[model samples]
Target: MEILDWIQDWFKDNCDGNWEHGEVIQITTLDNPGWEVEIDISNTSIATMNLAWIRNDNGKEDWYGVKIENQKFTAAGDAGKLKFLLGLFKEMIDKIEA
Candidate 1:
C-alpha cells in the first residue's frame, strides 16, 4: 500500500479516540522512497502527542511529536525533543537526496 494510505489507516486505528478530524498538509518523498507525512489536526487543543512508528526503506523508526503540555500528558521529560526529531528528519531527507 501507499505511504499515505498506510498513515491514514494507522492514525485512524490509533488516534480515533483523540481526533475528530484532520488533514494532510504535505507528503515529502525522500530518495529512498520513504516519505515524510505532515498532517495537521483541526482540534489542536484536544489533540495529543503523536507517537508513531516511521518506516523507511530500512525499517521501523519511532518518532514523537506535538506542541501540547498538560498534566495528563507530558508533564515530565523533554518537550523540546520534537524539534530534535524534526532536525533529524531534515538530515535524513537531505542525505537521501544527496
Candidate 2:
C-alpha cells in the first residue's frame, strides 16, 4: 500500500475514544523548505520500542532524519522526502506488528 494510505490506516486503527483528542499525528512544513512529521505512540503498539536517530544527507535537497523520542516518532527531511519519511514509519510499524 501507499505510504499515505498505510499511515491513515495505522492512525485509524490506533484511535480510541480519547486518543484522537490528543492528536496522534502531526505534519508540518519547515522554514528550510522541508517536511516534519511527529506521531504520538503513547498507548499504541510501538510505544515501547526504542529507535535511534536515522539520518541521511547528500545535499540541501537530499537530507532526512528520523528518531523516536518521548514516546513519539519524529522525522524531518527535504520536501521530496515526505513520502519517504512516512514510509519509514510504516516499516517500523510493520516490524512491530510482525
How close is every model to the real structure, measured as TM-score?
A: 0.26, 0.93
Worst 10 residues of 1 by lDDT: 68-77
Question: Over the stretch 39-90, how does candidate 1's per-residue lDDT look in tens digits?
Answer: 4534333345433443222233433332322311221112323334344433
Residue 50 in candidate 1, Cα distance off native in Å = 3.9
For candidate 2, lDDT tens digit of each residue in 4-98?
Answer: 77888888888888888996899999988999999999968788877789889999999999999889999999989899889988888888889
Q: Tell how far residue 78 is off in model 1, in angstroms.
A: 29
Error of 2 at 44 (Å): 1.8
Candidate 1: Cα lDDT at 36: 45
List the lowest-lDDT window of 10 residues for candidate 2: 43-52
Alpha-carbon lDDT, every model: 0.37, 0.89
Which portions of model 2 miss their true places by more than 4 Å? none
